[model samples]
Target chain A: MLGDIKTVAQGTFDRYFKMKELYVILILCILNIAALSRYDVLTLNMGKEFMIDGALAILTVVALITSMAVIFEKSRELREKTAHFIITKPYGRSSYIWGKFIGISFLAIFNMAILTAGALIVFKLTSYENVMANNLATEFIYAALLITAEAIVLTALGLFFSMFLSDTITALMVLVFFILGHSFYILEKMSSESSKIFGWVSDILPNLHNLDLKSAITDNITITQDVLGYGLLYAVLYAVAFVAASSMIFSRKDIS
Target chain B: MYAIETHNLYKTFGWFLSKRKVHALNNLELKVPENVIYGFLGPNGAGKTTTIKILLGLVIPSKGHSKIFGIDTHDPDTRNHVGFLPENPKFYPYLTASDFLDFCGKIIHMDAMERSKRKDELLEKVGLTHAANQKMEGFSRGMLQRMGIAQALISDPDLIILDEPITGLDPMGRADIKRILLELREEGKTIFFSSHILSDVERMCDMVGIINHGQLIEHGSLDELRSDIGVNIHTTGVASNALMEGEKLCDYITLKNGEAIFTLTNKSDKDTVMKFISDNGGSVIRSVKLQEELEAFFLRRIQNDEKAREEEVN
Candidate 1:
């Protein structure tokens, strides 16, 4: 049984080693860098932003997108009528679902790492924003720690959604929730001056904006320790909660 | 112990709106012995696929029980020795031929090197080595079906379950598939396949089960069932009026167009029946018994079933 699970895990990860999906991540990174280059704000302190800001945040978003893509596309055979080939294999159904989840997550992490290097290259080529380069580098490096935490939460949520829904609906629903998650930052700010109910709603929604430090990269800002710690705690809590829920749903759900 | 057995295997689905229960396999009882190709024959919607699904543990049997090699089908370990090719097999369109087999090997827990070696061997056996590097998206129907067979054998399973393994193949492709199935049978694999192609089944199967309306109408060795439903003895060239008069009033005789024909109650009685016609004013111009072809036998069974239904309706 241990061997069975390991083989499944290894095969699942090996699927992501495909060159086609890897190209998608590379294309996304080049596009991201090109978009960032268009902003003069990013040009102002490119090196400082690298030394002091979060590079992995962009990757976290991209990784989430890819994770959701693999969930819908790569692992869809489980629900199809012709999946009997895989379903008939030894202990197949659970292995496929979990294997696909792990494989997609591994690919996402690798994509994040690649994009981080892309960000680094941009910082190195531009000399105008050389101030606080060391700080920016430290900030970006720290971003890895935080964004990975964010990724766990995102992947867990994606897996949770995959449990009860078809691939298309799950992907669409995740995309919608992603938009909603980003808008919650505006709601969080409004909670300070507006109605108490509005503040309560903001509190209820996952504050995914904390995972994004793009403004800091462009404007040479640093997140406070208190905010970082709170965001880290929220990320951890959300990851644990969602992963637990995902496993429970996955255990009960019939992919076959 | 039986090589494969099913005790009242049934699969049911509940339609949400109408709340109707669809029993795909209704109390299906099956037994397949070792080292024999079992042909599962049925018209569309006869639950042939459903029974195969239960055998491979792809679907949960809603009622009754299914076992493979004496192990419960629901048990994961039971599938370790089994392989399957589903109807209209869907493969990963993006993976190259070798890569797909490697993937199958991995699921069966073969190490990478062994997986690679086995992949090549199975590919060669299925006649897919030349197209080994080609992605399946560009493969023709025959190619896809061949690839499906290769993947099914990647693990070198002891039991190979194929559902309509030859639905869309050219004569050569069909011959190739038939050869592979025969080879597997020679290697002592229990080759259980469902096919509408009775010729393939007739030429390949050692034993066969004919199913209709979610029921097993007949199950036995081909020779056994053939002799049971046996062929219609076509007696030809009898003198018209003499043959008619001779056949008439003979309670078991049937006449058609200048020939007297009837099924023998036993093989030993064929000569006796022919002798009767010759003795009674009619000369047995050409005496012969029907050489049972599986297709014709099955069609006759189907027509008989239809007529029975019509009579009941009237």
Candidate 2:
């Protein structure tokens, strides 16, 4: 079973790299981050902070789009009956889903690393006094890790929705969840003021705030190791729940 | 145990919201023995593909059950020795032919050394050695079909199931597939395939099952199903009046260029026709037994089944 998962993961990873659009998006995002850091166009005299923020935002978008592309390709495989080749093999459906999650998550991490490197290069070449004096390097790395966690969770959510929904519908659901997940605090407040159902909604929705370290980094609030650890744990638990549900649903599906 | 067996397998499509339910398979009972090429024949939407899907555990049977090598199909291990090529097989577009085969090899738990050896052997066998590194998206339909066959054999499985394996091939390609299948049979591998090409099936299949309207209309060996339907007698040189007497004993009689031909629906009538021709001073040239062609037999069985269903409805 582990061998099958590895095969599937390797296949998915190779296929994604072959996609020209993924590289196109990656290059565009890197250039955007570089331009933001070199020129203070977004905010005057605070180009370094703006670059970091813009880079993280761009990473989130890139992760969402890339993950959506994977889901859409998966939908095409199901629609075109290409998945029959893998599903009919001597492996369980859970292995296939896990392999897909791992493959896409690896791609997400790679994308984040490239973008982070591009941002750091621009920071060094420009020799931003504030960036060097404030020692924001560690915080930037922590923020990037947080974004990676969010990207992985979103990939899992996309995979779960894609089990029964079309690609378009799955993307819509993932986008909605992404929005609701970030606003989980507001939902919690509403539950105290009004209907108790909002409490359930907040509980059901993944708390993206747990994985959001951008504000802390930007506002100069200290993000300790324990917070980062808890965030990673939350991401893993949420992603696993989604992956387990996807596997259960996929195992029972009629792939005709 | 049979290599593949389905007992009272049933499947239906649509639900309460739909006005009608499409019964894809109704009590389909099939038994395919090991080490033989069994051809599954049916018209479009006649449940041939559905049955194959069920055997591969792609589709759950609404009722009844299916087993592979005496183990339930729901068990993933049942497919360990089963290789399948779906109709119009599709693969990861970005994967090369060799890479795709390697991935399949890994799925069956073949180590790197065994996978590499088996991958090369299969690529050469399927005539895709030249396209080993080429991406599958650029391949023609015939090339994809060959790749499909290669992947199905990468595991050196005991049972190979293919759906419409020869649909997109040229004559030479079809002949190559026939040769491969025959060679596999010689190695004691059970092959079950469905195809519209009855001529190829007739040449290769040791046994066949004909299905119509989700039911098995005919099932037996090719020779048994194509049993001798009649006999033909050829003779000459007696006079047109003598031909008339011989014609009375036969169901069909034709004369061209002073030679008379008689076709009898019963093999027993051949002796009587020969005796009559000889008594009338005509010499018998030859007698040949006429057997049904597989194509004709398949069509006749399906037509009879349709007629029976119509009568029942009426």
Candidate 3:
């Protein structure tokens, strides 16, 4: 069973990298970096703030697109019966679901790492002041980690949606979840006086806003290790729940 | 123990929509002994594929149960000894043939060394060694079918279940698959396959089950079914309708070139027909029961089914 999981995860990750969409998303990330560099130059040294924001924006968009593509590709495989080769083997359905979850999560982290390097390169070549090089590097790295953590959570949600829903609807729902999750704080505040259901909804949805480290760079606030650790734990927990739900549904699916 | 067994296996689909059900497999009872090729024959939508799916645990039976090697199919371990090739197999298009086989080996928990060795052997057996490095996206249908067979054998499973394994192959391709299946049978592997190519089934299958309308219509050893078709008496020396009229047991008579061929209506008439032919100055040229060809039997079964269905409809 462990071997089965490793094979599926490795196979899925390898296949994900081979996709043409990954390269397209990489090129788009590079173009976004170029645009950010141009904006930094036009502002005549804006002090590393917009550059971090630009980097996070690029990471979020690329992560969401790639995650959706990966999940949809897998969903299509199941519907098209290409999965017959794997599902008919000795492995359990849970292994297949977990393999896909881990595989796409790996891709999510890898994609963010590549774009983080690109964003760092962009910031290095561009002019910025009011912050030391080490400080900027540290801040940029934490921001990348936060973005990746959130992306991991969203990827799990996308995979869960893909199991029972069509690709278009799954993509749309994941997008909606991302947007709503980012505004979870605002929903919590507005619903404080409204109904108890709204409060539950806010708590149930992933608090993606908590993982956003961009404001730390802009507001000159230091993000402690404890806060980052908490955010990572939250992401991990949500991802686990979503994957468990997906595996439960997939294990019993007729798939005919 | 039987290699494959099903007790009153039943499957129904689309039960929620319009309150109608499509009975794919209805009260199917099957038993296949070990180390023999069992050919499953049926027309389109005759539940052959559905039965295979149930055995593979792809679809659960609505009622009854199936077992592989005496182990319930619901257990994942039961599939460890079974290899299945679905009809018109669809594999991941991006992986090369070797990589795909490696994945299959991994699915069955084979170690790297054993996987590599088994992969090479199966690739050779399926005539896919030359295209071992070629991606499946460019493969022709025949090549994909061959690759499907190779992947199915990657685990070296004891029980092989194939659904329409020879659908889209040239004569040479068909011959290659037939050879592989026979060789596997020789190795004491249990091989069960469904095919529209009755000639291949006739030549390769040790036992066969004919299914119609989601029911087993006829099943037994090939020779047993063949021998049930009755006897034909070919006589020389005189061509006459007198043999048919005199024998009172001959159902039909055909005369050509100073020879008469009589189809006896009953097995009991064989001795009487022979005696009468000898007594009437006719020499029995060849007298033997004609074995029913698979094609003929299949067509007759299907025609009978259609007639019965029509009568009920009327």
> Which has the greatest lDDT?
2
Query: Candidate 3: fnat, from 0 to 1?
Result: 0.75
Alpha carbon deviation, residue B50, candidate 3 (Å): 2.3
State the lDDT of candidate 1 residue by residue for A1-256, as single tens digits. 3455455556555656665767776776656664554455665635344333334546666766775755564345654444456657766665555555556566666776677667767666655355325476556645654565566556666777777677777878777766787678787677655376665675456667776665654575775666567777887677557656665555444334
Is candidate 2 or 3 superior in TM-score?
2
Worst 10-residue lDDT window, candidate 2 chain B:
B266-275
Highest DockQ among the candidates is held by which one?
2
Clashing pairs in 2: none
Candidate 3 all-Cα RMSD: 4.2
TM-score of each: 0.76, 0.89, 0.87
Clash totals in order: 7, 0, 0
- For candidate 2, the TM-score is 0.89
Which ten-residue region of model 1 chain A has the weakest summed lDDT? A45-54
Task: List ranges where model 1 is wrong by over 4 Å.
Answer: A1-17, A20-25, A31-35, A41-61, A79-84, A128-134, A148-152, A182-256, B15-18, B93-96, B129-139, B227-292, B299-314
lDDT of 3 by residue, B224-254 (tens): 7764667777888643646656556577767
Q: Give candidate 1's error at residue B104 in angstroms.
A: 2.7
Q: Is the docking of candidate 3 incorrect, acceptable, medium or high quality?
A: medium
Per-residue lDDT, model 2, residue B204, is: 97
Q: Could you give the candidate ranking by DockQ, starting with the highest?
A: 2, 3, 1
In model 2, the fraction of reference contacts reproduced equals: 0.80
Which residues of candidate 2, in runs, are more than 4 Å off?
A38-42, A190-203, B15-20, B232-269, B276-288
